[model samples]
Target chain A: MRADTEQDILKTELWWTALVTAVVTAIMLAIIYAGLVHHINPPSNIETVDPKTLHLTGEFTEGNLGTRVDGSQITSRIVATQFAFQPQCIVMPANRTVTLRFATPDVIHGILVTGTNVNTMIIPGYVSQVHTVFTKTGDLLMPCHEFCGLGHSQMWATVRVVPEDEFKPGPDGRVTCDAR
Target chain B: MALAPHPNYSAQVPPRVDDAVDDVALERVMREVPSGALALSLLTVGLLLLAWFLMYAFVFLPRGMVG
Candidate 1:
């Protein structure tokens, strides 16, 4: 009887161990499949810019800090300042790949778009970039996730994702919230 | 004639009568498999896996592609 009980315990433990291993393997396989098929990955761009002159003579200039279409590529350059994001709002087309580039002239800041996988941190000297495709069409809240200052609580921007037909850029190939 | 007890004498303690029965019960308990515990653990793990899959499918997958 003692030997029987020992065998039963060993069998049960082995079964549970196998089940746990299978569960973990399943999760890992799902993640790998998503990455290979859907191109889902974390944003890890390593580009540098001078924070002192970031706003003076670069792509992050005040006038260039919005969505612009260059040929078939859509890129939005944003500057996360001490308390607010420049432009305050950007417009992009749904179901199209868009590149969001962020830089900060002050302290560290981060942004995450609501209901989307667009999240990145903006360092003073580093340009954070995230390429994503927005499927839903609406004004999604893009909030500053990092605490910058006393006004950090109110630091947020809007991401207006419109339909492909309604995304009409001006002659300069730029789209802004005011244009909508 | 019986000898008289000393002033410091004490009575001997009696042994337990159910000692043999207790040993048998202990062996029986030790030999039994803990099916209830296994069932509970399996149920908890199953629920956790279900929750993870649900979030992955409904929330994470629907959020679209990003890099």
Candidate 2:
């Protein structure tokens, strides 16, 4: 009778352990299901500017900012891979918000808008967003915040803000670099 | 002459059941099972969570902008 009682105890203990394991597994699955079902299905992106606003996109080549500045597109001989990121001195209308989508192909960079309320990381696999209204009309330097390489300390670009009515086109109907 | 307490003790006795347990082998198995299982399970769950977060933030985010 004693041996029978011991065997029953062992069986009961095993059953209890198995029951606990099954309950824990069920709880984990329920949590994952909840996350998959209601956790914002996915992330989202905001169109922070209109189509008429200035939009620049290109590869940062070695030597200059590799973007055309002709009537067709804003192209420049500014090679960025070798030299610091020499962004064009943009003169946005006062009170107009400019949303610059900074991107890099080689390494991570930072778009630091001096004397403004915007600083962001420009990572390779991530699209960093910086939105700001030009409340004042002056020159703003875009400096690299992250220690990218040997020339990181001096890496920067220029952004020029101007009054609302001072923005005009050049002789060729294209907004030249000096139009502001 | 004291009746010898059944001198055929070895003749009619059932074999002794070995009830002694080896503590060393039990300790080794006890130490191995939980550690190995815990390491593998945690690694699998962690990787799964990371991939899920990245995909959700980047890929699906762009598509949601359509509507």
Candidate 3:
């Protein structure tokens, strides 16, 4: 009777162990596959833009600006600081596609374009790309959201959106501000 | 030996149990967390998430036209 009871207990423990091991293994495998495989082959970069595309390269650094007119401290907001490109001055054609790639010369930076609902983080060694379809013609602001250093709150970029015909033509027939 | 009065015959025994289960083994097993391991785990997870997002952008989605 004692041996039988011990055998039953051992069998129960063994079954539980097996079940737990299988569950744990499945979870680990799923995490690995999702992180390693999915990350290497994300779906965003495969899309391409047509000719006459505006290719702009921007570098962001930490700098400071004064407060607002109302005496409201603009420096208090996370989005108010840190910008390599002035988003408000970025001129783009309405009803067209635009691509913006962000890079940092020193530290990690994050670009947040509030008007068009675009956000991306850029690292020192990595180039982050943002693609947007500008369906409207208006002024916008692009601010840095990353908490880099003391000057992080002052980084700002300008974006200007103009009509398709009004875009300035580059020497290479590309509507780019910077030479490719 | 005859006791004069043992409290009440119908009264229950004292609440204090006669024996307690020792858990020294379990305690020893639980105290082995390595330093900075949690932070490292979080960093790993963040990097992994970033990699996955990039892959999803560059690979899985169709690259033809804007909807």
Best by DockQ: 1
State which candidate has the highest TM-score. Answer: 1
Q: DockQ for model 3?
A: 0.04
Report the Cα interface RMSD of each model, rounded to 1 decimal. 2.3, 12.7, 11.7
Best by lDDT: 1
Total clashing residue pairs per candidate? 0, 12, 43
CA-lDDT, candidates in order: 0.90, 0.52, 0.47
DockQ scores for all predicted structures: 0.45, 0.04, 0.04
Among all windows of ten consecutive residues in candidate 1 chain B, which has the lowest summed lDDT? B7-16
* Global fold similarity of model 2 (TM-score): 0.40
**Superposition error at A157 for model 2 (Å):** 1.2
What TM-score fits each model? 0.83, 0.40, 0.39
Task: Estimate, for each residue in A75-96, the C-alpha lDDT of model 2 and write its tens digit.
Answer: 2222233236545554454565
The CAPRI quality class of candidate 1 comes to acceptable
Ranking by lDDT: 1, 2, 3
| Runs in model 3 lying further than 4 Å from the true structure | A1-83, A86-88, A172-180, B1-67
Off by over 4 Å in 1: A1-4, B1-24, B27-33
